[model samples]
Target: MAWKFRRRVKVIPGVHLNFSKSGISTSIGVKGASVTLGSSGAYLNTSIPGLGIYNTVVRPG
Candidate 1:
C-alpha cells in the first residue's frame, strides 16, 4: 500500500496553492479550465464540471 498527502488552499477567486509530499504547485483558472506550474513541471487542465470528464496535458518547456 502507498500513502499520499496533499492539501489545497485557495489564494483568490481563480488562484490556488497546492501542497504535497512531492512539492508545491500553483494552479490558476476557473472550474472548467486551469493551468498548474510546479517543481515537477507545467500542465494544462480542462474539465466539464458536471460531466465527470477531465483532461490533463503536460506543457512543453
Candidate 2:
C-alpha cells in the first residue's frame, strides 16, 4: 500500500504556510519529505531521512 501525509509547519517568516509530506509518489516508495511555501515561491528543500534522497523530484525517476 502507498501512504501519504500532510502537515502545515513554519515554511517562512510571515508570508507563507508549509505543506509538508512524505511518501507522495506512485513509482517509488521513498521516505523523502518536501517543504513548500504558501502558493508560489522558491522551495526550501526535499529531504529523505535515512536513505538521503534530497533533490527536486518534479518528475518521477
Candidate 3:
C-alpha cells in the first residue's frame, strides 16, 4: 500500500507547514528571509541588501 500524505495551511503570511508518511516539514518566508525544517534536517536561506544569498543546513549526528 502507498503512504498517504497530508498538508496543513496557515493564515499567517510567509509561513507554510506540511506532513507526510515520511516525515514533517515547515517553511517560512518573510522580508527577504526564508527557513525550512524537515526530516532531512534544518535549512536556512536568506538574502541581505548587499551580502547576497546565504544558505545553511543542520543535520542530526
Backbone clashes under 3 angstroms, per model: 0, 0, 0
lDDT of 1 by residue, 1-61 (tens): 9999999999999999999999999999999999999987899999999999999999765
**Residue pairs with clashing backbones, model 2:** none
lDDT to native, each model: 0.95, 0.42, 0.73
Model 2 lDDT at residue 37: 30
lDDT of 1: 0.95
Tens-digit lDDT string for candidate 2 (1-61): 9776665444344333434463221222224544443333434455767876677634223
Order of quality (lDDT):
1, 3, 2
Candidate 3 lDDT by residue in tens digits, 1-61: 9667788676488888867777778888775577778878777766675667665666642
Task: For residue 15, give model 1's deviation from the true position in Å.
Answer: 0.5
In terms of TM-score, the best-performing candidate is 1
**Clashing residue pairs for model 1:** none
Question: Which pairs in model 3 have colliding backbones?
Answer: none
Return the candidate ranking by TM-score, descending. 1, 3, 2
Q: Give Cα distance to truth, residue 21, candidate 1, Å.
A: 0.2
Q: Cα RMSD for candidate 1?
A: 1.1
